[model samples]
Target: MAASGAAVLHRAVRANLTARALALVVVVLVLVISYATSLRIYFAQAHEIATTKAEIAQSQASIADLQSQITRWNDPAYVSAQARERLGWLVPGETGYTVVGADGKPLGGGLTLDSTPTDDPGQPQAMWWDRMWGSVKAADKPAVKKADPGKRAPVTPDSKPR
Candidate 1:
């Protein structure tokens, strides 16, 4: 009976040690999982903050560009330049002239007279009166001459016209 009692006491001690070991393992695992979760959250928040800062910088740059454009628009020179380029406006005391090509379209470089005349005189020269008469004749010619429908005769399908 004494030996049996000692065996039972040894088994109880072993069971208690196993339970304590299992509890310790569970606590360690929970600590490891919580630490990993905290690390993930921290990294995510850091990335978000970095992205937000970049967006803010980009927005600030756009705002600066808009402000600069506004300042330029506020200037009289800039406004005049825009009006001259966009609206074909003539400056005060400046004569407005247009050079038209044979196609009845305005010559390129729009109306600004800043072009330097080239010294190349290879082109044929016509008298001023002749050139004026030529332009008058060209302008007199219609761009599209409509066919005189009344001058045409109606034909039947059997006419077999070529």
Candidate 2:
């Protein structure tokens, strides 16, 4: 009976050892899975932070450029320069001269008023009202003659009639 009791005790110890080993393996696996999930989330958040920082830097650079432009526009000298260069403006006591080529095009993109057609060196320039009156008078004149339908040019395939 003493020998039998020893065998039973030995079997009980072996069963307890197997159960503890199995429980330890399951707990280890759960810990490893949780750690892997946490690492993935951490890396994703880190990447987002880096992207946001880059966008913030770009926005700051754009704001700086706009602020510099605003500062330049605030100056009166800058405004006057822009007007003279872009709009061909002339200030008081400044003589405005335009050079024309043989083709009659202005050399420096200078402003020309088409109203004064008969520009004479001896005569004074026409007033705005006089020019307007001249244009009105010209428009009041009727056409000398109308073209016959038979004389009209043949239409091309690419040309659409009005």
Candidate 3:
């Protein structure tokens, strides 16, 4: 009986390989799960990169529009238009009439010109010094002495206006 039992134990040991196969399967499943997680992260980063690229393209288009506008403004006609609109510039022997509340449209009795100036009419006119120092910003203005005697009237007791 002891010899038969010993022989059975030896056979059982030779066929006991199920546990090792199960361990290998578990390892393979862990590795697959890790790989899938890494793939998910990579795809997410790709999506973010795409969105950022689209934003960059939009900003570049806006910059291009601004550059075109800047170039257009350098033209003489465009500059003249802006000046006439902003500074009330008119050709010689021409008139500039304002029709406030009309907005370049025909008034259908709801709005009419108030006869008053559309812009600040009573605003104090900028004096010669103010305009020279403010508007005509001649950075390269060389010091010029008054040469003509009449142009530089002397402020003395004997001097008088002509």
Candidate 4:
């Protein structure tokens, strides 16, 4: 019976080409599935990385917009307008008029006419590079050292030189 089994196995290995081909195809399919699964994981990670980069770009754009707004608001004319409208300050020779419409509302759009544009030519202009350098230097400077009380001499009232 063992001899018969061996003969049958030999005949299957040597004679049937279609059966061997099917076995090879099944092995290839398993390898392809495994590779495809790994590729899917890699692609998912790439998507996450792309999303993070997009968020970073968006944050940068927002920061740039905010910085631009700060630059504009820091102007002398704009600041003066804001201060006068918000604080109700009146400069000399500047007239204040309120024209109420049919609804009995001021046409100043929540701003008063007493606002003075403080455009002082004598004020020193700030250079962009100087400000940036100063900020960098300030950040690099070491913290202030605390006063050493122990190293200081004891103070006495009405003390004179020896």
List where candidate 2 sits over 4 angstroms from the true fold: 1-22, 98-162
Candidates 1 and 2: which is better by TM-score?
1
Candidates 1 and 4 compared: the better one by lDDT is 1
Give TM per candidate.
Answer: 0.51, 0.49, 0.48, 0.52
| Candidates in descending TM-score order | 4, 1, 2, 3
lDDT by residue for model 1 (44-159), tens: 99999999999999999999999999999999999998888766898889987778889977886644444654645786567799989999999999699788989776888867
Instruction: Quantify all predictions' global Cα lDDT against the true fold.
Output: 0.88, 0.90, 0.80, 0.85
Whole-model alpha-carbon lDDT for candidate 4: 0.85
Backbone atom clashes (below 3 Å) for every candidate: 0, 0, 0, 0
Measured with C-alpha atoms, the lDDT of residue 101 in candidate 4 is: 86
Task: Name the top lDDT candidate.
Answer: 2
The candidates, ranked best first by lDDT, are 2, 1, 4, 3
Error of 2 at 91 (Å): 1.7
lDDT of 2 by residue, 1-162 (tens): 999999999999999999999999999999999999999999999999999999999999999999999999999999998888877898999997878789988886545667755778788988899999999999999769887999988899988888
Reference-based TM-score, model 4: 0.52
What TM-score would candidate 2 get against the native?
A: 0.49
Tell me the spans in candidate 4 whose CA falls farther than 4 Å from its real position. 1-16, 84-89, 111-162
True lDDT of residue 112, candidate 4: 48
